[model samples]
Target: MIERDHPTLSVGRQCRLLSLSRSSFYYRPAGETELNLDLMRLIDEQLLETPFYGVRQMARHLRNEGHAVNDKRVRRLMRRMGLMPIYQKPNTSKPAKGHKRYPYLLRGLRVERPNQVWCADITYLPMRRGFLYLVAIMDWHTRKVLAWRLSNTMEAEFCVEALTEAIQRFGLPEIMNTDSQKMVVSSRVV
Candidate 1:
């Protein structure tokens, strides 16, 4: 890998030596400037420490610590960082406009055996250079990962692939549980 080569070799030189075009070494630049990356890193660490901090509060905290950051910039950075306020939702989770949604029939129901209930979740994994979306389906009774898949794009195809694999291997469940996240739920249904 180019990243594994001698530290003294410039990336352009390495590309030439490997008979690769500099353009082919395509990597998206860090989303922020080096200075901004430092700020974002600090903000992320601080947010993890105190998730309740809003943009205003975070800006105040940073200013108190001598980081001359404003609330606007902090808010933008937090948004880019995927930080958001957490709150409970009272209404039923929203679904796609045309997709049919089934009522929660398994509420208060007991699941005691394999294939009784399956739960799936999709989460975002942030990396230094990019991000990935991960989806996993687990048997509620056994607490085992029946299938999982990762993708750089948050599309429905990967979710379908995971579900299809699980079905091919373990068979379908009595009921599949998942949040109303559009990509996940939609893929499973259609």
Candidate 2:
């Protein structure tokens, strides 16, 4: 709670004391117009069927469906809704600058035991309202899930927690492999 008019504390001082941003403390959400909301719903439904649609393509789609929308509006709506075209592109998952790169050690290595090789990965699970991230650790040889965690954000903490739980429960593997997206944190754990 924020006291707009306190006896001694100013609003800014109160916000600072509470560790809250002044802008956020005074922010008010603007309601979306009904027409725009309807268009957003249409765009979301269309996105479900065509996950590869970009701004221009989506605008064309909406136009074809008898909606008076342009690329700029579609782009803004997509940005607001956090809708991005899912496609294969070069350099999509590059490592952060100055991060150490590890050699790919499992090129031809054969897994013979349960603890020989373990793999971990994080993937997005889309839901009706929003999305969640799933981090899973699995034994390569046995194809068994050692540990898994679900989070609403893609923070490294959840991935690290999942890895720690797996290691604590199933013991350390000879090699733990993970996708490049999560390699930065998993490397620290390994």
Candidate 3:
């Protein structure tokens, strides 16, 4: 540690003892350039309108608006501003080839009874160390979670197990519904 106000050691002697260059010690960090600041302000406003635009698209948009910006530069400024594009991230819900999609039965149907309509959905659960997948079977009318299961893996077995428990506890519903994504995602038989 260099003590500039120390009565004993001179500033030059302190620098020598610390093995530090004078220029480096005197150097203060200067923030982003003026052009970068203006660009970032424009980017901030445009980001609110279209949050799905990624680095390349954002750069192209800026270039189209007569701003000389590259993807790398746009990416850097966006990163510095802590901004990320909102888009569909790849997940484990991709359907298999030639899978038959079923029509939604409860679209206009009035679910008057508890067991009249049932639905199941799957989502991710945030954990301290990592994440766990959760599948819940709910009664449409009661809005109750009849059965649920948590699994570290996204296998169909856990989802099926939850559904089986719900069906065992209560009689079969008139209509069975789940997210369309769960068609080929969870189980083909469910």
In the order shown, the candidates' Cα RMSDs to the true structure are: 19.0, 17.5, 16.8
What is the lDDT, from 0 to 100, of the residue 165 in candidate 2? 95
Maximum-TM-score candidate: 3
Ranking of candidates on lDDT, top first: 2, 3, 1
Off-target runs (Cα >4 Å) in candidate 1 are 1-95, 181-190
- How do the residues 4-51 of candidate 2 rate in per-residue lDDT, one tens digit apiece? 889999999999999999999989998788999999999999999999
Q: Residue 60 lDDT in model 3? A: 91
Q: Give the per-residue lDDT of model 3 (tens digit) for 60-148.
A: 99999999999999999999999998764437678778977876655577779888778888888755345688999998799999999
- The TM-score of candidate 2 is 0.49
Badly placed stretches (over 4 Å) of model 2 are 1-94, 181-188
In model 3, the worst 10-residue window by lDDT is 181-190
Task: Report, for every candidate in turn, its global Cα lDDT versus the true structure.
Answer: 0.79, 0.83, 0.82
Per-model TM values vs. the true structure: 0.47, 0.49, 0.49
Candidate 3 Cα errors over 4 Å, as ranges: 1-80, 83-90, 181-190
- Scored by lDDT, model 1 comes in at 0.79
The candidate 1 region of ten consecutive residues with least summed lDDT is: 181-190
> What digit string (tens of lDDT, one per residue) describes model 1 on residues 1-190?
6874676998888899999998879866756788789889989888888776778878998999899899999999999889974433233234557976657857688989998888888887755345678999999899999999998877789998998999889886878887863222332443
Count clashing pairs, candidate 2. 0
